[model samples]
Target: MTATRPLLDPAAARRRYVRVCVLFWLPLGLTIAPLVLLLTQRGLGLAAVAGLTAVHSLTAAALELPTGGLSDVLGRRAVLAAAGLLNLAALTLLALGTTPWPLALGMALMGAGRALSSGPAEAWYVDTVQVHGGPGADLRTGLARGSSATSAALAAGTLLGGALPWLLRLGPDLGAATSGRVLPLSVPLLLGAAVYVAFVLHALTALPEPPRPPATLRGVLRGVPGTVLDGLRLGGRDAVVRRVLLSAAAAGGALAALELLTPGRAAALTGASESGAVLFAGLACAGFVCAGLGSHLAPLTARVAGSGERAVLLALGAGACGLLLLGAAPTATGRFSVLLAATGYGLVYLGLGAAGPNQNDALHHRVSGAVRATALSVQSLALQLAGALAGLAVGLLPPGRLPWLLGGAALLSAALLWCRRAGHLAPPDVSSPAEAVRPGVRTDAGEGQRLL
Candidate 1:
């Protein structure tokens, strides 16, 4: 038998993983602040923009499972590289495309890239850690650090992305030169594309996995569907997994309410759409900064709460309170209302950031490495689907506190899921060093190995 290659030391692996996380997320941050503004500048109406955003969400939701399965079957590095290439194309199209069709196509491609990239990097990190330190490895610290890096990247990108166009407009003829074919707003997207190139290179070179049996095309085609199905069934089979999925959906609903309604509130406060956009961008940047701080504090949160489950419960409860505060913001008048809104927004993000690492750490303890990426995809899918539903519902409701209240209610319910502990929440044994270290090996034989 061929000897298995030794894995990187845990500390070295973690540093590389954190670096990759920043690279993967920074480009996304660069585009987030300017994407809608750029699209509208190209003559797209609000409805058209909404349609385009829906296309991205639906495409990602549809592809999430299959792409995750592909990662499980093929490998993380290859899948991540593919996502980068697709995102590069997507960003290019968005930056330069003038017509609705091209832009729509770009959105679809971006969604596909989002789905493909979602889980693989985190899965790779967890697998590497467990292989080095056993199934009981200290995963929260690394996970929290990665989450912090992601938020920091996003915060920096949002500031840079929002400022680049304004800076371009200041120079004589600079706006005319860049804004004629490619608007100054599109510069961020172009920069994001360049970043994707770096992301692709780094993903290829930096993330190394243990050798697997050479996969034939037929094997991959056959394996992916099975893996996806197994992932889907995981929620039903495991109590802890079900709780995680449900909580993800609830969190999604809360976030959807915020994203859908917050801009209008900002506009209401500022009394102008343009200024509102600027204010929203600043708020968004601040939110990310708060989230990064929260993520950095996650390990400490877990330590204080006594268990991952308790930490998640407390964190999500805080998020629910934030949403409620937002719901109450409109009831106040003048600067007080703005203050309420801002505080609530920061709290919501902070709580969510803190909750995420603890929740995932609990999740990682329950599932095997073989299906790790697929599991994360399922969690993401739940969030996307629930957010879509929540957006629709919030849109139909009478304006004011109702929408925010609905989100607050959803988050509170999710937080309540962890109020009581179950026996199944305990971590499974993988004390055998070889078994714990083996990537892609099925650990749930008694549950039926036939699934693999």
Candidate 2:
């Protein structure tokens, strides 16, 4: 039998939350890519950026199932501390090395750090928020807050990436060599290393970790397969989880394709002129700002989505339409298509951020620590795998031809989510409205008679 975890102390939750935002993730956004670009002088070229992203996603995919299990057995706070140290090591490497091999090594290490940090933080938040409200309506609200923090970090990081080097005049004056300007690239990583060290300290003394058995080599190997199996089982048994994962895979796949081919797509839209690249970058930046703003409005969008499942379905549906629009776009229509796609992306994230907690809280009600961690990792792995495949497919076709493929993928994603809701629209939990743990806990989906 699966026993639910108790809600933790609220004040502790707030401390951890604030620490994660300012210390860990924000610094990450500020650190890695821009500095690396300075060393490589690549200026957002496809191979360099895409390779970094692909390696990161692949590492996350490879580790997702096992890392979650590791957290389960070792404790979330310990793993997070280890992760902070690893992040420091990664940035340190980037500061000193510029070759593909060293940078690749650094990027891979960074991805490993991401694997360690991402899900655990969400798990921590879920555990913490459940304390005050019994995972009540506040669960979704908490996720919204997290999403807001992330968006804010992203916005700030993007600006810093553009501003930091020029602010220091570290560029051309640094004396460019055959390998480009090394000094400009070195600064961000060194600064980030210090920040990561702070994160390590915070994780150690500030965060509360539960007691667990000493980690064993044998247990880690045994736990991997077991945890993965548990995750598969949960998805197989639960219609909603299954839908979310499938939708995740499809959306992730499309997003991966977008990441790979967006430049080319933008160029094609803008008539492939000398200014096309700048236009594309600016336009995409604008779209990102819109997404950050959307995070602020997630509560309102949640209401618009009606119920959690419906919100997910609507997000998926909009993405499908956006994809088709891109595929069908012409000279005049392409601009409109990109705009729609951006809108779709922002709206979907809003729904996910708002409804994600509800789903997570439901899972907490359904399983134990190790199993819950494993389940979340399974979703992450599916997304990574989908993204990996989409990225690879980018090269199989001509650079400009990726729009249609993304469209088809989006359609498939929408259909899958719709099917998940068809089977089990779980009723809201009346017994513990405070800890609503049905399929989706936020909405008042009332009654045993919600009979699908």
Candidate 3:
């Protein structure tokens, strides 16, 4: 039997890979996300959170294709730096805003940072690995490691967000508080800035840079429309791409719905008191920690399931079940039972996160650098679109309907996964059709022929 090739230069791949991974996740975890909506000024009402998320998602969607192209044209290092700056600005805005309009704007700006950061980090890692080593290789090591780092950051961030609100670490409540001790809103926000700064400094010092010529302002603007269209076309044509997009959309939708609704769900599930606050914080940390674990375990789970598509379906199914349990957890055993809800949320996220990058890696083997960015951009578009619509829908629903709304999103996510392009598997190497379906594939049908 032939031993498979290494994914990239394992050592450089490991170092640069870990750096980029942490850079992408650390600041993101500390700022602009779960805390912004869930533990916001009003205790994260469903409609309010959903509305803010929708706006944030829309901003992300707006930048998805553009940022992907920027990575291709400008190089990943620059994009990563830009992303960090955008995040710092966004966190500042989010922290300062008390009302909806400013909050929405803050969310939107944060989403732009999210959009710019998304594909570039992985693309850089993959490109670095290829230059140092060879091609058509095993990517799971780097991918899994990166994912593990991200999960770690997320786990840490979840704990921080939960405790930061209640901690009396700050000097005094300038604005005043109900209790003698006070945790100002600026504390978490500033912490987020600190994390972003750390990530930026790390990136500059640790990661390797390659040659990249800058593009003119006119050239960049002209390329945007074509970039968006071409990416959509490429993704649409590829079987693996199709399945990845669906899986990503489903996962994105489910995640958006869960984050938007869960704070209120926890508040309602647990009574509103100091003890209740502790419980809610504990549950929030538990949910994210479990989610991170699910992300780390995704490769194994996908292997068992036989493909990314099936894995996504399984994850979405788990999420759907969790939503139901969360919705009904008002009984004697109800509060204890909602742990299942957190578990399902994590599993679904795992599926979504794993599928897209794996599929993009495969497609990169087929396409050249110029177009590769576009293909990945298309994947970003699909995920963002799904999240945006789901966020809007959840916000539009009446205040108390979040659980059902989340359940509906989970079902929709399942539907999208089930509709994956299952016929495109070509059984690379010696793998069987059954195996291909588990991993999912595109039969040169998309690119007309697989390239050397």
Candidate 4:
């Protein structure tokens, strides 16, 4: 008989949560500030850069379901470690490559890594806690902490990545000696690769997977595809899951527009690439800090609003308002324009941060351990799909119109939440043909039907 694994207690859950936060977020944050700017600096145009980003999203979208299913079938630790390895290789390529095709290739690899890492850690945490504390385990507190930690990591990494290139300039002049071979902007990406190596090592050493049937190559091949199909059916058939997925897609569009437009705006406002990098970095840091604060406030927001759905509506509404402000900021003069842009940017992050845990909590309530990671992947696929479309659209449009378009979409997304409130909600239908074959281990309908 297979040996039963020991259950994870609260303290162990907390430890796993922290590890997930650090491993998943810190490396990504380290490269965010300079990623677009570095591409532009390396001679790609704005449209090309956007296309590269779309490629990343496309790659991630393609792999999201399969990778998630792989985690469910095999184990979270193994998949997470594999993601770290892919990321390390991708980061190295990003730092060293000098051409557009090479850069695009790196981004594609990074996307695969992203898809793999997306849900496994959180799945692991939820599975552990459920095994120990049962279905009623408090998830919001841990999820909130994880979200806040992610934001904090982004904040620190943005600040550091933004300043590192400028800081490197302070050292002895390498431009002349190296014949302009050493680009300061590439330093952070290389550093990020080192961090990725560390994360992989840490994941291997620290993350413990609950014992299950040892997965064979054949089993993995057969099981993963089946799990992916089941996950897709659940997402399509379940009302709450469907709503959350839609919300994620809307968020992706909003974020894609912001990311595509903001760096260029900062560069234009600052009037130089180096100064633009610094300006964008500082603004990104501030935005991430605001996001952390918003995540910290998620539970409180839910409490205040009397329901999670209402809180999502409020947060999305705030985000829409911020995007509208951003759309109008360019019309203003001097310092006011800068201030408005910063405020709008911060508010957008804040709203998204607040919405994240709430939506994930709702998702968690509907999915069981068997398909949890797969469900999260389905959500991620939606986000990446929307982001890819938004990136392509924003790339083709004039920068001035991008924010307005995204703001309208955000409003439409918020409007969706209003259509279903209070008692109108129903438990997910697990009786569908596909789900009946692989029924969810947990029936969350009892708590899921509750107001908040």
Best TM-score among the predictions, by candidate number: 1
Per residue, candidate 3 scores C-alpha lDDT tens digits across 1-452 of 11133333566766677767765676566553345443355355777887776777678878888888777666676778888888887777666656567667777878888888777777767666656544445555567667767767766775665556556445556346534121364566767877788777766555564554557878777765665565666554555556556656666676667766766665555655555455555665556555555556556756887654465566556656555555544423274555655555454444444443344444555444554555566667776677768877877888664545565566555545554435443323311211112234446556322211
| Selected candidate, larger lDDT, 3 vs 4 | 4
Query: What TM-score would each prediction reach against the true structure?
Result: 0.92, 0.78, 0.74, 0.87
Q: Which stretches in model 4 have alpha-carbon errors above 4 Å?
A: 1-5, 36-54, 98-104, 172-182, 267-277, 396-406, 422-452
Q: How well is each residue in 1-452 modelled by candidate 1, as lDDT tens digits?
A: 12254667889888988998888789889998889889998999999999999899989999999999999888888999999999999999999999999999999999999999889999889888988777667889988999999999999999999898889777666447655677788889999999999999988887888766689999999989988987888788776778899999999999999998888888888988889888889989998998898899998988898777888889899999999999888744388889998999999999999999888887777777677899899999999999999999998999988899889999999999988764332244444311211222333434412110
Ranked candidates, highest TM-score first:
1, 4, 2, 3
Q: Judged by TM-score relative to the true structure, which candidate is superior, 1 or 2?
A: 1
lDDT of 4 by residue, 271-342 (tens): 877787677778878888988988889889989988777888888778877788888787443798888888
Tens digits of per-residue lDDT, candidate 2, 315-412, equal 45555555555555543435566675555544434444443443443345444455556667777787788777776776677744355556456655
Kindly indicate the candidate among 2 and 4 with the higher TM-score.
Answer: 4
Q: Rate the local accuracy (lDDT) of all candidates.
A: 0.85, 0.59, 0.60, 0.78
lDDT of 1 at 419: 84
Residue-level error in angstroms, candidate 4, position 279: 2.7
Instruction: Give the residue spans of candidate 1 off by over 4 A.
Output: 1-5, 172-179, 331-333, 423-452
lDDT of 2 at 198: 85
